[model samples]
Target chain A: MVDVQAHLPVLIVTVPLIGGILTIATGRGWKPWAWATFLTGTVFYFTIRLMMQVLASKTGMVSYELGNWPRQWGIEYRVDALNAFILLIVGGVGFITTIYAKLSVEKEIPADRVNFFYAVWVLAITGLLGITVTGDAFNVYVLLEISSLTVYALIAMGKDMHRGALTASLRYLILGSVGASFILLGIGYLMMITGTLNMQDMHDRLMSVPGILESRTVLVAFAFLLAGLGMKMAMFPLHMWLPRAYTYAPSAVSALLAATATKVGVYMAFRFLFTIFGVGFSFGMMPSGLVLLLCASAGILVTGVTAIRQTNLKRMLAYSSVGQLGYIVLGFALANLHGIAGSVAHIFNHAVMKGGMFMALGAVVYRTGRCDIRSVRGLGKQMPLTLAAFTVGGLGLIGFPLTAGFISKWYLVQGCLERPGGWPLAAVVLIGSLLAVVYTWRVVEAAYFQEPDPGTPPVEEAPLMMLIPMWTLIGASIYFGINATFTGHIALTAARSLLGGAP
Target chain B: MTGVLGIYNYWIYVILMMIGLYGVIAKPNLIKQAIALGLFQTGIFLYYISMAVIDGGTAPVWTTVQDGAQKFQGPYDNPLPHVLILTAIVVSVSVLAVALALIINIKRRYGTIEADEIEAMDIADRLAEFHAGAAADAVDEAAAEGHGLEHAHGGHHHG
Candidate 1:
């Protein structure tokens, strides 16, 4: 029984994987089956949390070798403070998104397509969870492709905006596949040099190979991995597919991907740079820190500036998502305990903020049948609760004090200032926050200040089904902000582990 | 430099990768872009396969007649990259198939597969709609401003 319990993390992913296949086999008449599968995923999420607590208490890490194989010889699934924290985020967001999807799917998706959507949703979640939990380097790329492919399908299924969604999904598919290829190539190169695919083994092997630290091949692999993961994470220049995909996707799909998908990619990047490659090999040996810093700084300014000009609420949020990712990257590039902690905290913080905001927007769309800023005028008076959730979420985006966003930005700025000549970087980070305020305030202004058209019909509040989860996430954003000790402790410990110390 | 042919093979993979990347970046058509993505993935596959090849490697499968003794030597091919590439190929094909399906749907709805043209159409529609809204607002403002004077004159005549 203890051994069985030890497999809970893997079970969390595998249950969904098997459920997806079963869902497809049952076809369209299996709504109850779909719900059951989704519920199972929710159960798995809770179990995963329990397992995380146990791991945190016991050995301070969880490692499971697949097929009863030894770690170095076969695939390994390892969860530590770093990944377990991310696993919680992915699973928690995934559970809520699944519940939200149950109601939203019935409205937006055709009856015939609902089953397929649920199947793909489960598969995507499974892939994301796998990516987060797996300790094997190549497995990340495989799981990434699985999630990316399903995401393309899910996005392409949007109602009348099929053209835009299809185009966006295609663009993502092309770019995403190429990115995965680069990752695969980079992993191949790493394996060629290290003779192992296990991340810890690769790290250990990499240390002893003479001149391996200075190998151009290693640098090339690093570049490939960075570019590949950057595209998936929607880092600024590679963010072309983001706006349209987010705007046109079924709102629930948008929420899930915004909350969890790209965050997984970010986690992968962190894992590669900080753990597998090791910080000293990457930051101390190469110019990676500078490269990441430059890209992140540019991403923050460019994407934040661009966000303010978007008229569509979803598009604006998408741009904000890009800017937020830049902040996370910047935190990682700072290359310190504070920096890594801030980045990790932001991972959780941004998810709640973006997820809540998107869910609120989805609620507005549900009530009013439009996502345009003009359409949401006077929504604050009508859908007061949903709009209030949006306000809290928006404030979080602006890094207002007592919101989760502020805590992340505080640490990130502190991280930046820890280095010499870091004040300018800190200023840029502050400017990014100000830009977030501008765009978020734009929505608030439109929602509250603009009067409703006299002839328009009155709208009701979003259904309680949707409002419940939206408020739950909003509450989490505030709750985490106030009692950040729990999250902060995990983040700090995770950062230490990532920086090569055992928790 | 002593092994001249090995260097040439590496360059071929590099050229292939660049070609695929160029096509993906330069092409505007969705289908063409998907093909380009496939080519890029194939380039990686080529690189991996080439890396796996030894001087005189045979196929990886073993025969019972050979007493299951593996022929692992300098002349044997490294099976790892081949295996990895096979999985990569499958993933690439899956992505391609989905991308192509999306393209078909795009063509069905928008009547064009050109990304630029579709974007142009969307922008033009938005601009036209924006102009119409501005025109409506102008008329509404003019009507509101005149209605005050009409109301004032009617009230005075009635008094």
Candidate 2:
């Protein structure tokens, strides 16, 4: 008999991989195949949740060695609280996005491309899950590139079929590829030094290497990795590709990439910083923490200010995503237990909140055929249910009470307050939230207060398939906000594990 | 002197990287920008290959004819970096192909590949539309003023 629990992590990744292949092979004639792919994602989520319970119950980590090889020589897929928490976020959002995609895609994408879209969608999810669940450094880069390549293709197939979509996707592809190369080079350099690609072995080797502490090569490697990953996360100065891509991509693709892609990048950044480099060396021995802090602070301020000025609703949300990523990076830069915990929680919280918001926007675009502020005028009277979902999502973005966004910001503020020089960081977080309120309110104002144009026809609500998933995310956002213990407990435990602790 | 030559190779790679980056940043043409990106990627490949070079190292292979003897006499150049860079090269080309396709599409839709031109066109369209609305409203005001003047004159005649 197979040890099912031991095989769960690989299954989490493999199920999606096989489903992607099946989706492509089945072609457009089999709509059920796409649903099966979606069902696989849902089942994968349940399996991860079960694994989380197992970890919580045993208070231990699960490490699966590929091909029955030893830890140092062979590839390993390790899952602890940190990845389990992230897996839930990725899988959960993926499920909701897939469900939302069913109807939203029918309206936006051509029937001929529908099956291919689902195939690429599942492949992207598989790549992301693979990146999260793996223990090999080089594998992470490969998987990152895989997901990024598929995303570029998916985004380029937007409704406009204009060069803008293609151009934006191209820009993202170029930048993303360059970033992945840098990460790979850095990993190669690490391998040269340690003679091992296994993360834990590299960590142990790096501890005792003489003169590596002062080696310029190592420092350059770190810099390259940081810059590359920063681009992937759409960190401030490197965020030029995001707005156009989000604006031009198909609505469902936008929702999925917005919700989960950058979060995966953030996860990789954390993995490299805390696991491979070791926190002591990353923060105490190098200037990485301070550098990340400065960049993140700039990202928060600049992106937040810029987001408020955007007239297009989807582009505005994309910029808000940049600002939100800054918050997560800022939390990571704090390098304390509370700070790390907050960062982890925000990963889950932001994914849900942003996913829901983007889905609502997708709903509006589906109904009105425009995502511009002026186009959505009098939407409250026309598409009241869709507008309600948008309102909930907007409130969440503002960190309003009884919303998931509040939990993230609260923990982040608390985390910053606990540090010695954290007052400034705390102030930046507060200012960012206030700016979020401004931009989110801008959309809400246009949706509710503006009068409808005289000759325009009344718009109907989004289809049931779209509305259900959007509201489910919105409701979950509110539910988690009220009872954060579930998210909070896992985040705390994950943070501890990431910091290399038993508890 | 050989060691110095090795160091000089790295400096060349650095310069290449900087040039490529400058092209990516400064060029306004999208195709040019893509080429620059390609250049940037090639520069990294140069760095990787340079780092893997060894002193009089032979290619990594084996000769079965020589009773399973290794091919290299001296320290063999690291094949790992070469293998890794091969994968990277493929990925870079894939991206370039896709980007080029997009650039072609952009040219077809926008009729130009210059970033600035696209921005200018989009801005001009908006500006012209805005001013056209204002001009129509101005014409309506002038007509209303003329009609009011005629009505006043007619009223005076009737009195």
Candidate 3:
């Protein structure tokens, strides 16, 4: 057990990587699904174990160098309180979505391609986990490309359903490649100055080097990294590719990407800003905080209103995702204890909420074969459980009391009140919630009040397979919302460690 | 002037990258966008490869002395960046492949790879879907109000 514990990080990534490629030989039908489920389940178990080990370790950190080589020359896999929390979120969501995906994939994708689909699916999850676990900055870029390529393929798979999916995927590929190149350029600049790719070593070198922090090269690197990550995370004005991609992708893909992809982008931002750059250089010497704060605030308002205007429910939630990400960015940009903690907590909370909501939408598509506002009219009678889950998830999005979103928002508001001239940001949060109410209410009213179309065929509730996973996520959100001790504790621990507090 | 001339490769890379970016943004053809993306990545690859160069450096291959006591050498070009760019080149090729595949799919589906034409087609599809949904709502309203009119959209199938 001790030996296995030491090798957990690399094993967690490699198992899925090998397993995903091997899934292609699984052939068709339920074979690939079963293989994927086992792989994801194993990964999820490893994540939980790693999280416990991180807590149990002396320094709240664990480092494993490849092939027993020295740290400077070899790649390392580092796990700390911060990334352990993120790994748990990604792993847990991947496992749950894999279970939900079997039914949804069959309904959506063609049979011959199902095996390849699952292969790419697991590969994408592997890339996400790999990026979260690696210590080398160059490794981050490689894994990022792995994930982006797989995601582009995944979104393009939706072309059979709608031709627009083709365009959406192409647009994303072009933009995503540009963003990735910018990141590559940034890393090149950093390597030129520091002569290292290890993140912690880079930080130390930056500190000891004379006047390097003020240099034009380092500044350019910072700008490029920030812009690239912003585009990846769909920050405000850079979020154009998101709505259509989510709207057109296969349902399970949407749930997986919505829950995990952008959250990982935020995680990368945290690493670059807090871990490598240090809070002093990032927030003090640089004007990034003020810049991020403004973008996040404007994103919250603009995306919230735009979410209300979307005719399709999936598109609406996609826009809401952009808006919710704003709160997370705002929380971290504040650079205060409560603010960063709130950011961390919301990562978990919003994952559960939005993951559950997207799963519910998938179920709606499964049953009635449509997801527009009109198809759900009078769906309350036909699919009470699914719509109820959506309604509750929407309430969580509005930060209603006794919901997980409320806990994060409460911390965020307290964080705002902690700073002078933060009240305006607080008001923006409130107004954003109000806009959420309007959009969510649109769905609830359509489902509950209006009559079902007499012309369309009658529908039933979603299959048991789909409902179970959807409710599991929704139930976890509510459970964590009421008893915030676990999430709050982990989030605060991660936040404190990020701010250079005692580990 | 010497300082600027010293880094001529970087200047060329910048020019190539901007031109590629311009094509991606300004061109309306899907295939052109894919080609432009490749050009843009090639510029970045050039940046990485050029930065790895030293004034009078040799290949990174090491040669050992007969006694193995003087096995070290000075002024070898950095191999790490070249290795890194090799992986990046693979990534770029895969991206180009995917982009071309998607372009082929767009051509198959819409019969045109022009960006504006695809946008127009998508908008028209959405408009038709909106009308169908609205027409369904009208039928529902008519039924609820006990109106005699039953068929909406003149017998067009709703679902």
Measured by DockQ, the strongest candidate is 3
Model 2: colliding residue pairs: none
Candidate 1 stretches with Cα past 4 Å from truth are A1-3, A25-40, A43-47, A50-58, A501-503, B64-75, B125-159
**Regions more than 4 Å wrong, model 2:** A1-4, A29-36, A39-43, A46-50, A53-59, A159-163, A501-503, B7-12, B53-60, B65-77, B122-159
lDDT of 2 by residue, A45-153 (tens): 6656655665665656677898888977677987777787777778878887888887777777777878888888888888888898888887798788779988988
CAPRI tier for the interface of model 2: incorrect
Q: Rank candidates by TM-score, best first.
A: 3, 1, 2
Query: Highest lDDT among the candidates is held by which one?
Result: 3
Tens-digit lDDT string for candidate 3 (A356-415): 999999998887666889889899889999999999999999999999999999989988
TM-score of each: 0.92, 0.89, 0.95
What DockQ do the predictions score, one after another?
A: 0.26, 0.18, 0.42
Interface RMSD for candidates 1 onward, in order: 12.3, 14.0, 4.7
Clashing pairs in 3: none
Weakest lDDT window of 10 consecutive positions for candidate 1 chain B: B150-159
- Give the candidate order by descending lDDT: 3, 1, 2
By summed lDDT, which 10 consecutive residues of candidate 2 chain A come out lowest?
A: A159-168
Error of 2 at A365 (Å): 0.8
User: Residue-wise lDDT of candidate 1 within A1-503, one digit each (tens)?
Assistant: 45656677678777788877667656564473456446555645655665456555667777778889998777898878888888888888888877666666776777777778888888888899889889898888888888998999888877343345666777778878877887888898888778789888888777767788688778888888888888888887787888878987988989998999889989998888878788897788878899888888998999899899876788889989988998998998888989889999999999998999999988887776556676677888998998899999999988999999989998999999998898888998999999998998887887899886443457999888898888878899999999899789988888888787332
Q: Write the per-residue lDDT of candidate 3 for residues B7-70, one digit (tens) a residue.
A: 9999999999998999999999988888888999999999989989988898877678888764
